[model samples]
Target: MTALSLEERFRTGDPRALARAITLAESGLDAARPLLRAARELAAARGAAGTVVLGVTGSPGSGKSTLTDALISHLRSEGKRVAVLAVDPSSPYSGGAILGDRIRMLRHHGDSGVFVRSLASRGALGGLSARTMQVLALLEGAGFDWVILETVGVGQSEVDVAAACDHTLLVVTPAGGDGVQAFKAGIMEIADVIAVNKADLPGADRTVRELLAAQGLGAHDASTWFAPVRRTVAAKGEGIGPLVEAVLAHRAYLGAGGLHARRAARAEFEVRTLVQERVLRRARELSGDLYARVARGELDADAAADALLAGA
Candidate 1:
């Protein structure tokens, strides 16, 4: 018997095939480029349904995984097919994911409707996989209604998740001012919603008030959609319902046109980043003697860049 194509397997929502397609996408430029093209074409042909990409990011002890589990339960209860990409810290030696997110979300294993994947950051800055956008496209093409991207617990510079997602949910805990600092206006301008997780803990209300005050003080237009802060005890499943409503409200706020605009912006960023990365990869694959020459001042920096671009 012949093997099924990636497109066919993905269209049928075959978990194994989805995993392989993501793996193929993770491979370097030469191997990944064609697969991405074919995958996009196939996605278009399959009438790929719109999937909401929710970015969940925060500090390490913010209960992000538990909150994800709670959100998954809430979404699944609504009959949505959810696919989660949990971006984890990569082992520097082997370039493998730590797999903590997958292990933490282990309860969903029996459910075919819930597909959870763990991805190694693999030295990608900003707690996102370089191929995250592609993987999300694949999952949506496979007909998942919601694609949740859980980033590695983040700091200020981990802003790439903003570009890759339609709606960013910044998860923070009630750790006095630490949670507030992570959701500050400038670095996390992409966040549309905030969740104060571990809300049952002390200082939870204080955290919520601070977030509300921050939102008010933010430079964004109050005439438009303001980021709503919600509280959740994810481990105990408290307040998930309200959090779901807030997310749904944001989705509704997007409407058709807003969603299109967001997707276009995401594509633009993805394409530009991919081009730069591919060129750099190709240049690095070329003779190191070129770099050596530049270093030795045989060529000016601009000239070296031009030569590399041309060679790439």
Candidate 2:
């Protein structure tokens, strides 16, 4: 249909319109600018200050997808309309999501209140699609009470999710050596809530202790938010209640002022990232000959970069 009709339908929270809007958004900033502008205006008009955007990230094999599935079930049970943006690694050849949406989250297939979409990371080092923030705005404008961003779980570089969501959940498994690795990766510092999934396994209690000890190492005052470490057997839906409660508590801790600050930071990040992307695109367009010159030793790498920027 026409763009105006699509925007109208999206304003009414039509699921089909939301899906189409996300697809258009993924295309690129220029292709989706009008629609995204509309979404931003709608969100501002609605004063969607309480919208919950949760970012779930962790190392690979941390049961992140299963945890997300369980989270969807819990939120749905609580009568919240939820939308999930699952970022999967891109297939090198096809540039498509390697793990498609249909394969996971199968039970929510027919749920009108829930929307699940898989995005190809497209080789983004941050483990999220380049256009993820734009698509999230569309979801928010479409009236989803909660939006969940499940990243590619690429260990060290997955920290970008913290800037994109209101709260970040880091999932780890017992006996997986995650305590040390997460510390080294700096993911621990970014997590607002930590979940030890597969808690029924051996060494679960030890893992919990290790996390608590790690938290102790960081200096904190009365105002500090000590990220709660919760145990969960997500596959069996065990301990999901406490995990959900922890997230809600964290949200409460943020309050309206804190949430607004975080959202403002996110908007700044989004704008900065878009500017960088556009500049890089322009650099690539102008640097073809500069690259050849550098390869031929006719110009130094730094000089080539200077020329590129000058041209930009």
Candidate 3:
């Protein structure tokens, strides 16, 4: 389709067109740069403040899909036009997602008020597809009030995804074992809210207490409303309401002033990353066999480094 038609489709909230637009946006700069820049400019001109981007991240099998389904239902029941973008790890062998969360979220399929899309991480290491934020903007411009970004729980990348959102919720299970320790050092710090999934399990309370003690982020606070530890049996939809409330409250908290700063930072970060990618692409285009020569010891490594750095 033509650019205008594609843009119109995105504006009209056509899922097929949204998928195509995002694909173009992800397939490197040549295909996406101009359109993405124009889209951002349009967003600025229209003064379309983004929807509440809620990022949910945690360990694998943490029941994130179930939680997202319940959360989406809750938001829809509240008359919110919601969008769920679940980012799954691309298959290492086939480079496609093995499990599509959109299928699992089909409970809202008949509700035009709710939209769900699944994105493959596409071998992107940071738990974030480079096009994620742009796609989110597209969704907001389509009039979605709430956008939930669900990520595969894979350490640093998941943390990066969480940092890109207005509010970050972490889902964990009671028997996380040593996984909790890793979170303390990394993911837990970025969480605005935490939920212990499978709360019906034996040691649910203990897990919550451990998380609180580990992160010092308790429920009662004034400075930075401490991350609340909610219990949810997502399969049964228990405690999902409180989870949704926490997400909304966090959005309000961030929107007051923090949202602007955070979004600005995310925008700057994306720009820098794109610039870096462009520079590397150009360098590779110019270098050709020179890199191979250096690797094969036909050229001095230091000299190659110097030459590449000079070109950069």
lDDT of each: 0.72, 0.79, 0.72
> After superposing candidate 2, which stretches have Cα over 4 Å from the reference?
1-4, 29-31, 44-49, 89-96, 100-102, 123-127, 155-157, 292-298
lDDT of 3 by residue, 112-142 (tens): 8888877775433444655776776666555
Q: State the lDDT at 258 in candidate 2.
A: 79
In lDDT terms, which candidate is top? 2
Alpha carbon lDDT at 252, candidate 3: 70
Task: Please report, as a residue range, the 10-residue window in candidate 3 with the lowest summed lDDT.
Answer: 39-48
Candidate 1 lDDT, tens digit per residue, 29-71?
A: 4555555665556544533246767878776778878888988
Instruction: Summarize candidate 2's per-residue lDDT along 76-118 as a digit string, tens digits.
Output: 9999988898876524456555464336697798998888887
From the highest TM-score down, the ranking of the candidates is: 2, 1, 3
lDDT of 1 at 130: 54
Q: Name the Cα RMSD for model 1.
A: 3.4
For candidate 1, what is the lDDT? 0.72
